[model samples]
Target chain A: MKSTLDSKNLPILLPVLAFSLVLMIWELMVRVGCWSTDVFPEPLRVIISMGELISDGTLFKHVISSLFRVTIGFYLAIALGIPLGMLLGRREIVKHLFNPVIQFLRPISPLAWIPLSMLWFGIGDKPAVFLIFLSSFFPLVVSTTAAVISINPVFFQVAANFNFNRLEVITKIIIPAILPSIFTALRISLGIAWLVVVAAEMIAVKSGLGYLILDSRNALRMDYVIDGMIVIGAIGLFIDFFMKRLGRIDSVFWASATR
Target chain B: MGHIVIENLRKEYSNRRHFSRSPGSNPAEYREIIRVLDDINLEFEDGEMVSILGPSGCGKSTLLRIIAGFDKATSGSIRIDQKEVKGPSPNHIFVFQHSALLPWMTVRQNVGLGLRNIEDKARMEEKIKEYIEMVELGGFEHHYPYQLSGGMQRRAELARAIAANPDVLFMDEPFTGLDFLTHMRSREETVNVHEYIGKTILFVTHDIDDALIMGDRIVVLGGKPSRVKMERTLHFPRPRDFEKYPELGKLRSEVFLMLGVPYAV
Candidate 1:
């Protein structure tokens, strides 16, 4: 029990210690007049601004809006990309037809789509969500296709020997076989999606944390900008933690553990 | 009714080394066919356990795969019970050399893979339980393949193969990776199971003793572009010992010599 507590406490304790050190350095720099207070506000000032946004509900509203866009976009991408990826993985002809096109599009940044997205969707959450979808779609497709292709040929032989029907092959053999890789892909694509959501919100939407960061900077409320930065970082960390928890499920345990 | 016939079977793979490694530098040498099995012919009677042995990479596995309909021969046919084999079917199951149990599935679920068409739920469960008990993997039914020891994993695979009720079962070096004691136990269990079920099993192995002890008929293949070097029926009774049958010892020594080994060791 004591050892377990020590292990758990280390993760939290070390981060807290580093955080306090950073805060101390920031406050010290401000006191030493590294820059003017207006441009680079003290850490305490940012904390006060964080509390202010929390009580006034602006931070909560922005967080929900950002998360809402990410959810709709990420889900839509997976809903379409995963099936298409499975098809490409299975059929050589389909891969030959679609692979070049996807490879061409994958390297183009989502930020490059901002002007066109705004023109097409005309502001609001639509463009931002579309950007998030575009950012996540290609990586997910590539990862899923690779995952499916790497499934052991032995399992396919097993499937054939048992006379598994087309539907049964997909449901029993392909899906479960690639599930661990799919989880890894999701964690990566979700990170990509989170990154794209911020850049997307900066240009296409009005209420997300990105907009809060940009709007505060324009008004020279550096404290509010810092608060937005901290919130985005915290939320990113939370999302990563959640995905990691999902990976510990019993079905996945077999793949991850050496046992 | 699992009698199998291989007629003038030939397997050749062109050396991809030139193209893949050099990338079109040696265009003329690309179609150079390296034959693995040359004009091979064999017959396996119904319900007979035949163990095939060879020098390593003598196409014992290739031959097994061809007979099981997992791969194609360049110019030949494999007929099982008078039907020409085209592809893998439910009538025959291949127990892979490695544990091919789907890692995500529990022992019960992996075994249940072959029992999918059973309409009665209770009957399906009963059958799964029966096979699990057959391999003495009773309590491990709920455990994943990863959680089990190597011996247990092989037993679970054995249970799965028998549960399928195939007419012919193909095992490609099924005892390749086990420890000595585990390998012995697994081999013993396999013989007992074969005796009880009386299914035709095509077993491929590198171990000469395994072929001699387990097979009703032992067939040895050797040399490059291998063909059957020796084929004989073991008429010696059950629990065959080299000491009890002097001929078994001579035969074992002969196989070792044929494979270019100076002594039995």
Candidate 2:
């Protein structure tokens, strides 16, 4: 167990060592007056600020609120996006009719939806969630549609030849074949959800990491601003990691991780 | 009663948008449905091995697909065992040219995929093993399609097709991609499997030698909008050796003549 732990620690040792080196240099530069402490806080000072915010429950409040908006928005996107994708994929008439509309909407940036979201849903978690949903829905629908449409016709024929009914064909052959791509789409959409929600919260909401960043800036606290930015980055990375783990467990996506 | 009949069966695939019309034809005729079969009629008895020999462009594959109900005829009736085949039936098993084994499934899983209703795990395993051994793929049961060589993949497909125990088996150029020795072995395996299973086999191939080796009756189809041109019945003993034929060259010349291939006898 000790040896296994050491082996795993070896991979992380380089990044940990590099982080320490950078921090030491940062401290030295500040002490030498090459860079002002006001402009860039030291690692120790940033850690203290982080700890204080956490201890005072401000950080948790913002994180929890952000998570709530993102989750609701993300779940809504998945529920609606997947079925729409499948419908458009399987039916030629639907694809021909809706493709132009989807193409027109896809190119517009999620940030561009902010004013409309505000106008439509009002300034609150509603607007933020709406923005995240818009951001997440496009990629999910497009990827899943492509996946569903591109299923090998031979697989369908095989199922039919075996007298497998329509439900069985979709549930057994079609779904399993497209699962890898669907998971991929979900991951991409989740990333978009996180990104667009942050931007939306900065303009549309009063609580969340994005709001916290603006609040810190207004109070002239650069350290808290930087701390909020770091928290956002960490959360994004953590979510992506968990999404990938889920993909590996649920789908035949061995290539994505292994390669 | 378990038989197939095709009468005046025709198919026409519409042209793509880019290739709208010929230079000689009217441009307003943007859509062109190229007829693949024209007034073709044929019948197969139950438990018969019939080989369809035709040129590459001929509609042998289309005919098989039509009979299997994989594709619909533009205008025709196909009765399998006196019932019109509207869609794919559980009675027929098709072995495609490329094996068509799902890459994610192992040999055993691929074979047992069609038998999902067989809830008894031991029986499924037994049937899978039985067919796998019949096609000489018992050792490779755990291997995926990608892991197997081309010849092995064909064997796996054969094993899977036979495992379903269908009343009719449709094999379309299943051994064409194999090396000569592998092809010979695979051909032997196909014959052996057919004999053991006693299933009605509709085997399609361009190779006359393959037809002679495995078919109880061979139908030669040729020309555009292909139709059955010639039918020859093979009355040789079971498990006949190909090495003992004295008039093999003459027989091949006749096949070439039937297929419009220029050959000197």
Against the reference, the lDDT scores of all candidates come to: 0.91, 0.82
Q: Please give the distance, in angstroms, between residue A257's alpha carbon in candidate 1 and its true position after superposition.
A: 1.7
Which runs in model 2 stand beyond 4 Å of their true positions?
A1-36, A42-44, A54-57, A115-124, A204-206, A247-250, A254-259, B13-25, B28-33, B104-108, B118-133, B136-144, B260-265
What are the runs in model 1 whose C-alpha is more than 4 Å off? A1-8, B16-28
lDDT of 1 by residue, B66-149 (tens): 888889998988899999999999899999999999888999999998887899989999999999999999999999988899
* Candidate topping DockQ: 1
| lDDT by residue (tens digit), candidate 2, B192-254 | 877777778998998888888788888898877787788877877666655566455566678
Per model, kept true contacts as a fraction are: 0.92, 0.53
Docking quality level of the chain pair in candidate 1: medium
Top of the candidates by lDDT: 1
The positional error of residue A152 in candidate 2, measured at the CA in angstroms, is 1.3
